[model samples]
Target: MQLLKDQERSQRAIKALIITPISLFIMISGFLLLKDNHFSQVATTLFAIVWGTVSVVSFFYSLNLIVQVFPLKYYNKIIPFVFVGPAILILGWYLFIPTLRSLYLSFLNRNSTAFVGLENYKYVFTDRTMLISFRNTILWLLFGTLFSVFFGLLAALLAERSSIEKIGKTFVFLPMAISMVGAGVIWKFMYAYKPAGANQTGLFNALMVAFGKDPQNWIGTAPMNNFFLIAIFVWLQTGFALVVLSAALKGVPNEIEEAARIDGASEFAVLMRIIIPSIAGSILTVATTILLAALKTFDIVFSMTNGLYGTEVLASQQYKQMFKFLNYGRGSAIAIIILLAVSPVIYYNLKEFNKREVF
Candidate 1:
């Protein structure tokens, strides 16, 4: 009873010590407002300085006491909180609070003063730019990620154990190292045009002229331009998907492949039945990753097409709203849409991971 009492007393003492300086700082800062004009400014700055200084000092003191109070035997259990507490607080401050604030802002008018209810969300559904944004977003979701995953998986299967596999893989994975902006710049040049004989710097137009065809503005067309930009994203991301899927492919047991061959399975049949099924988990992981990347894509589209030719995605549209149009409410609505859309992806990925752990 005495030992338990002593422990409880020490804990209470430590907690009190930890909170005392924080309370003092707040009180002193509040009291500084009562001073005269010149004195008040000086007092306020000093109050801020003192508040910051004392807070840091108190935090370290509290941490030191916490380490000493918790025994070495229980340190492992206690250390995680010490390490993760600041991160959790920061996440709450930056992610959770900002997200809640944005959602609240979304319900307000453009100036963020009036309660506009669902006007902003309604604009998202009905506005021409937003409708185009949704259509382009769907195209990116369907074609951008799908082609990357498909080509990646196909490449993984094709290059499994060939003699030149390493060289082929090195070539394929080269694009993953480049930044999205750099990839866009490179492809921009590739699709460049200058009205038939004004230097022919653009590779696509150059190729066309070589075939005696007129130089055309490739990135200015309607649906075709969208696909061309999507192809750039597909090229950049396929390398990442290929590398991960190929690693998973390499993990498949040799006995399984040999058994399939012994059963007189065709090469294609073996790949379809034995290999793909075995790596389904990895495939799903890669596909989900690519889909998420596609959903959040802004830099590639902004750098390449600048969301022109009716190619605005949700991310670019969010930027266009907030920065170009200066409509914070609509911008926040678009941001919330993206957050909600990604929340499901994130939840599914987490659930999938949990399922994998169980199996």
Candidate 2:
């Protein structure tokens, strides 16, 4: 019986191994054929939809068959790979491989042909524009994140108590719908500058003139201009933090707050000792999310100031090095630096999520 069972398992394994390759080959060949043959736009779309659905189903079915070929003892362990293996492979191919390539390219010269070693990294730290970018980015990370979370938590608390909670929250949250570039363009007009004697067109300038002040160049003003950009980030991100923190606040037990109040705790004391501590995890999550966004801030700066007048962030600097200057080495080095800067935050965020069983 044991000998017969072994023969049967061997036969099944051989059939699975053979069939999996043949199915994959046919799947690839059919996709190539479909791609190569020109069809009308609607017809091509239809074919692609059908082919995609069929291909996914067939591929997963083949994977399951391969997994089933394993012995019973290993079946549970191997089965998970049938579902997760494709995602792992895709991430490895697209994300991991490119990261390694960027690291390698960071060591090369401008043309990516000759070895330059740490010269690119040296320039990244020592270059005038790069230093300014680092400063501005740090400001963005600090102020942008601080104001966003602070205002968001404040709004969430206020909205929870307001009679017209939905209406107030809706108005505050509406900015979250605007794209960063769209917000930048809208604010650009608000900060638009003209000669002092001329009529002010920009909203801020017009307001300044209304208040008997000169229409100053808002975007052109160094150091402070970065804060103005940070304001846009705060505007866009605050709504997100509000929604998340509001939900988290709701999760805090009312009994705890009531108990604290019964014990003669003030509103502020209750907030500090009870509510905030209870929702600390959510606040940290929101802060980290905003921090990552601030770290990678590019669209607004690019759209409004184009990294001019000390408004440069790491992302905009990387863009300039890659496209404007066509310096691959410096670009890759800056890219790696940005990656390294964000990696710790990402790891911390993931660790927190793991502790919370979020995944």
Candidate 3:
């Protein structure tokens, strides 16, 4: 009897092992069938059927494990997802299929017919507008992030001892809570300008007029308009910078500051030598986050200047190409180009943080 039971248990184990590997192999092979364009339709359908089978098999396998941990009473909860099976169907319809389609579309032509074979990618590198947008993207990565970090650091330093520090921080962080579209609209009003003669509603133009300078069409200007648009991003980002760096600043021990002070260091010298070094990791983290944000920024340039007048960044250019021109290949190329540019910086920053363990 014992030998018979042992053989049965071993058989069950082998069966589980066979099912798991076979299920996974089918799942993977379903996707590999897409190598030929001629097979794309069949391969796409195969993916859905094979993936669904894998999911059903894997779920039962995983369900037994989950049952051991979660109480039996909660088993009712799992039954609902089983009933509404279509939430998953909706995800494939809205998210997964569309994403796969876009990636596939990247290989096709401007009209999405007769494969262009990376001509769009070549334009991403060689076209004047795309190149200009790339340069502007770099400027945003550098100056936009730097300004946000600098101002946030300054605010954190200046507000550390204030009675109204909460108020000051709240004001600074208010922009962060606002949606990007809202911030863009707000900055539009701030940068609002009329022709030199009419009364200006724009805060910037009002200030210019206050200084007796004529209110110019700020958005219509060359290269400098890009800077003006970038400023809006910095303004919105600085508060977040301040909050994170301020927490980091507080971590710098008072003993170190006191020792620097006792050694006859000026306040600025103490901040430079003690505070700055103490918070360098946090500062780098904030700067990298800001760099990512600036790289991805679309609404500010879109709302303020619409990628016109050399204010184009990759994100805005991608939107204009995909949505406005309906050029899927060019749009996907722009996206891939921006991803290629920023991915390294982001990867490096992630590696540096892991090396430092700053978080």
Best by lDDT: 2
How does each model score on TM-score? 0.81, 0.89, 0.73
In the range 230-348, model 3's lDDT, one tens digit per residue, is 78888899999999999998899999899989989999999888899988888988988888898999988887778888999999999989999999899987877666667887898
lDDT of each: 0.85, 0.92, 0.82
Q: What lDDT, from 0 to 1, does candidate 1 have? A: 0.85
The sequence of per-residue lDDT tens digits that candidate 2 reaches over residues 1-359 is: 88877787788788778877877886897689687877888888888888778778878877877777777778799888878989899999999999999899999999899999999999999999899999999999999999999999999999999999999899899999999999999999999999998988999999999999989999999989999999999999999999999999999999989998999999999999999999999999999999999999999999999999889999999999989999999999999999999999999999999998889
lDDT accuracy of residue 341 in candidate 3: 68
Off by over 4 Å in 3: 1-104, 352-359
Question: How much is the lDDT of residue 223 in candidate 3?
Answer: 80
Candidate 3: the clashing residue pairs are none
Q: In model 2, where is the ten-residue run with the lowest total lDDT?
A: 64-73
Give the clash count for each candidate.
0, 0, 0
Error of 1 at 16 (Å): 15
Q: In model 3, how large is the Cα lDDT of residue 262?
A: 92
Alpha-carbon deviation at 321 in model 2, angstroms:
0.8
